[model samples]
Target: MEKRRAALRLLPVLLGLALAPAAAPACEPALNGTRVESSRFVLSYQSTPIEVGKHFALDIAACSKPGAPEPESLKVDAQMPEHRHGMNYAAKVTKTGPQRWRAEGLLFHMPGRWELSFELRAGGTSDVMRNSLVVASAPVRFTEEEKRSILSHGPWPPKLVPDPSNRVSGNPEAIAFGERLFFEPRLSGTGSVLCATCHVPYRGFHDGRARGFGLEDVDRNTQSVVDARFNRWFGWDGANDSLWAQSIRPLLDPREMRSNATTVSRFIRNNPPFRTGYERAFGKKPPEDDEEVLVDVGKALAAFQETLVSGRTAFDDYRDALESNDVREMQKYPEDAKRGLKIFVGKGNCGLCHFGPRFTNGEFADTGIAFFARKGVVDPGRQGGIKKLRSSGLTLLGRFNDDPAQATALATLYVEAQHRNFGEFRVPTLRNVARTAPYMHDGSLATLRDVVRHYSELDEERLHGDGEKILKPLHLSEDEVSDLVAFLESLSAR
Candidate 1:
C-alpha cells in the first residue's frame, strides 16, 4: 500500500514536467540596431484559409520607435515559398496616428501558403517585418448550363483555307525553297539584315522588342510567324488580308526590308540556288519581270512561316487528363498548379479574353494600355491599318499576289468596315508567356505578378480616354494570387 502511494506521487511529477512550456529561442538584434517596438502586424481577411474563387483582404500595421516620423510609404509584399512566386503589394494606406500606419487591400484567386512582409520606412531609415499565412482549397461547383457553354467548337490543328487557284498546299519543294529565301539576307536591300533577324525561330518566331528596327526604326511590334496561316487578318492592325499580301509589306517598307520589286527580282535571278528552287516550285524559270519576281519571293517566305507551332505544355496534359477522368495523370501535376488552374478557369475570368488551345480568341479589346497620349501623337492602331490597306499598292488587290481575286475581296471588305476596327489590336497567343516578360501590347508591365496586380486593381478612370471600360478589381488573397501565377508558368513548353 505504501509502495503504491509512492508510485502515484512520482506519476504526478512526470506529468508536470511533460506539460511545461518550452524555453523561447534567443531573439536576434536588427542589423542597424533599430529596436522594433512591436514586431507584430495584423492581416485580417474576409476568410481564414481562403479558398479558390473567393475574395479576401489583408490589414497591416507596425509599431516603431517613439517620435519616429510616419513612414514615407508603408509597403507590403507577399511571396509563395512552395511555388517560388510573389507580388509587390499595392495597399491603400491610412494614418492611424504618429508612427503608426495601416494598410488594407484585397487578394484574389486560389488557395496556398503566403509570406507577407511589411516595409516600414521613415526619413532615411527602413525595416522589414514578416509573417506567414495559410489558404485552404475549396470544392469546385459547375452548373450543367455553364459546362455546356464551355465546350470548344473550333477545329483542332485549325482548318487551312487554301486558295484553289494558287495550288500551294502540300508543295514540299516550294516549302523547302521558301525556307531558304526566308533566311537569306540578300533578299533585303542593305544585305545586312535577313528575314530571320526580325522573325526569330526560337523566341516565339518574334524578336522581343516593342517596335522593330531595320534599315530605319519601324514603329510596330514584331508579329510572330507561328500560326500565321490561322489568322483571318494579319499585323497588329489587321492591315493585310492574305499571307502572300502581308509578306510583301515588310519587303517594301522603307524602314524594314527596304527592297523594291526591281532590286529583289534582279538578286533572285542572279542567285543560282534561288533560281533553281523557284523553277522547281513554279515549273518555270525565274520570272524576268520585277513585279513577278517580288510576288514569288513573298509566296516563298509565307510558306516557311506557316509551320511554327507551339509544343505541348503541362496545361495541355493536365487538361486532357481532366477530360478523360484519368485520376492518375491528374495527380502527377504540381498540387499548387492544379489549384491555380481551378482559379484560372473559374474565378480569375482570364478565359474571357484568353481562351482556346492557343490561349487567344483572335479578338481585340482596350486592355487599358497607354498606346496614345496627345491628339497629334497617336498610335491609331486599326485606324492606321485600314488606311494602309486601302492605300498600299502591295495589297492583295495588286497583281503581285498569288491569289489576287480572293485576297482583294477580303482586303476590300476590311477597308469598307474600317470604322468598326478602331483602337483594336490582335490578341497574341500566350503559349510561352512566362519567358516573355513585360506583358501587354506595349510591353509595359515588368513581370507576370505586375500584370495580375494591374488587372486586380484596375481603375475605370485610367481607361476613360480610350472609350473602353476598365477591368474590375479581382480582390484575391495573397495565396490565391501566387497560385494563379503558378498555373500560368505551367503553360510554358520549357
Candidate 2:
C-alpha cells in the first residue's frame, strides 16, 4: 500500500516529463494545455486559471500508447486535499472524438490548495493522474478599465485650499484658537458638552453612535470632520453652504448645545483664555455685535476642523502602485480586495456617486432609504437644506461672507428646492468609512455589510419617481457581498 501511494504521488510528474516537448519549459503548461504521459496512456489537458467563485471548463485529449491495452473509459474530478471536500458542482463530460473530450460546469468556490485528478480505467484496474495548484487569495488580474477606475480613487490627502468666504480660514493663529474652541464645553448650553462631545477625535472625529447625541438626539448620523475641507456643502441635508455656518448650527440647536448667540458671545468675551485666543486669531478683541462674535466663533471652529484630514489607507497604496504599474507593490494588496473593487467600480455602479479622490461627488441623492423621522414627520433632506440655505444670514449671499465677490456662493445662489430633492442627502466621503459606522443619513444601517446589503436588495418602489434612475437591486451573491465589504474596508486607514 505504501509503495502504491508513493507511485501515485510520482505519477503526474512522470507523465509530465514524458509529454513535454524537448524545447518546452519544465512544469509549465503550453499554449493549449499541460501534456502528460505514462506507459499505458498519453494525455493532454488545458484549463483557464482556476479562480475561486468563478465557473470554468476544461478540455482534454487522451489515447492508449502503441502496444498498450486501450482504456475502457476516462473520468475527471477535483478536490481540496487538505479539506477532503470535492467541488460542489459536477462537470458534464462530452466525447468529441476517439481521443478528445470536454468537461463543462466546473467551479471552485474556495481559495486554497486543490488537486485535479484524471482517472483512466482498463479491464478491472485504474490509473489516477493528479495535478496541484493554489487558488490565490487575491484576484489574478484586472481589466484595463477596472485599473483606470481603481486609480481614480487615489493620491490621498487632497490639497487644502482656504475657504474664500471665511477670511481666517488658513491663518495659523485662527487654527490654534479654533482648536481651543473645539474642546470648549462652555460653548454648549450645558457647559459639559463640547464639539468634541459628538465629534470625538479618538473615534474618527464622529462619535460612533447611531445618531449624534449633543444635549439631545440629533436626527441624522454625525459625519466625520476628517476631510471636511474638500466638501462643497456641509451636513447630511446640505443645509449649510459654508463650514462656519454649519458649525454655528449645533451651537444654537435646541437639541444640541442650545446656546444662543448672546450666550456664546458673552462666554468668549468674558473668558480670559478664549478672549486671548480670539484676539490673537482676529487681530482684536471680541466685537460688540453679538451675532458677529458668534459667526467669528464659528469661523475659528471651522478653521480648526479643516485640519482634521485622515491618514493614507491601504487602498491608497494600491492605487499609487497601480498608477505607476508597479506589479510588486500592487500584489501586496489582498486579492479579495481587488475582486471587491471590481464590483465597486463595475457591477455596483458606486463610483457614480462616490467618485474622485475624496470618494464623494459632493452632492445629494435620494438612495431610497426611508426618510420618515417619525410616524407624522418626515425629514425633508435636501429640500429642507436649500430652504434653510436661502433663509440663512450666514450664507455667502449674506453680509457675513468675507468674499467681496461672493465667488464661492454659486451653489448657494442658484440652488432651489424641488420635489425630487425631498429625500436627497449629501454623499459623505468614504475615507475612514469603516470607522464611522451606523451609516446613512438616519444612521439606520449598522455595519458596512448592512450598507452594502441595502443597495444589494434595494426596493425601486420606495425611490422618488422624479429622481435619477441610477439605483436598482444588485442581487449579489454571498461571495460578491464579502468582496465588496473587503474593498470598502480597504478604503480606511490600516
Q: Tell me, what's the RMSD of every candidate? A: 10.5, 8.8
The alpha-carbon lDDT assigned to residue 159 of candidate 1 equals: 52
Q: List model 2 lDDT by residue over 206-264, tens digit each.
A: 89998899888878889988888888999998889889999999998989899989999
Q: Worst ten-residue run, lDDT, model 2? A: 24-33
Give the clashing pairs for model 1.
107-475, 107-476, 107-477, 108-476, 108-477, 110-480
- After aligning candidate 2 to the native by TM-score, how far in Å is the CA of 42 from where it should be? 19
Q: Which lDDT values do the candidates have, in the order given?
A: 0.65, 0.86
Residue range 1-494, candidate 1, lDDT tens digits: 99999999899889999999997523322222223333332222222334444444443434434455545667656677887877443556665654444545535244578776667776687667666777666654445533332333122345555543244534777788888988888888898777878888777667777667778766566777776766656887767777766887888887898888988888878888888898888788876788877877777767766665555677677666666778789777776676666666667777777777677777566665665623366666767777877886666666555553554365355455345355667777667777665566665676788877777777666553545452567776666677778878887775
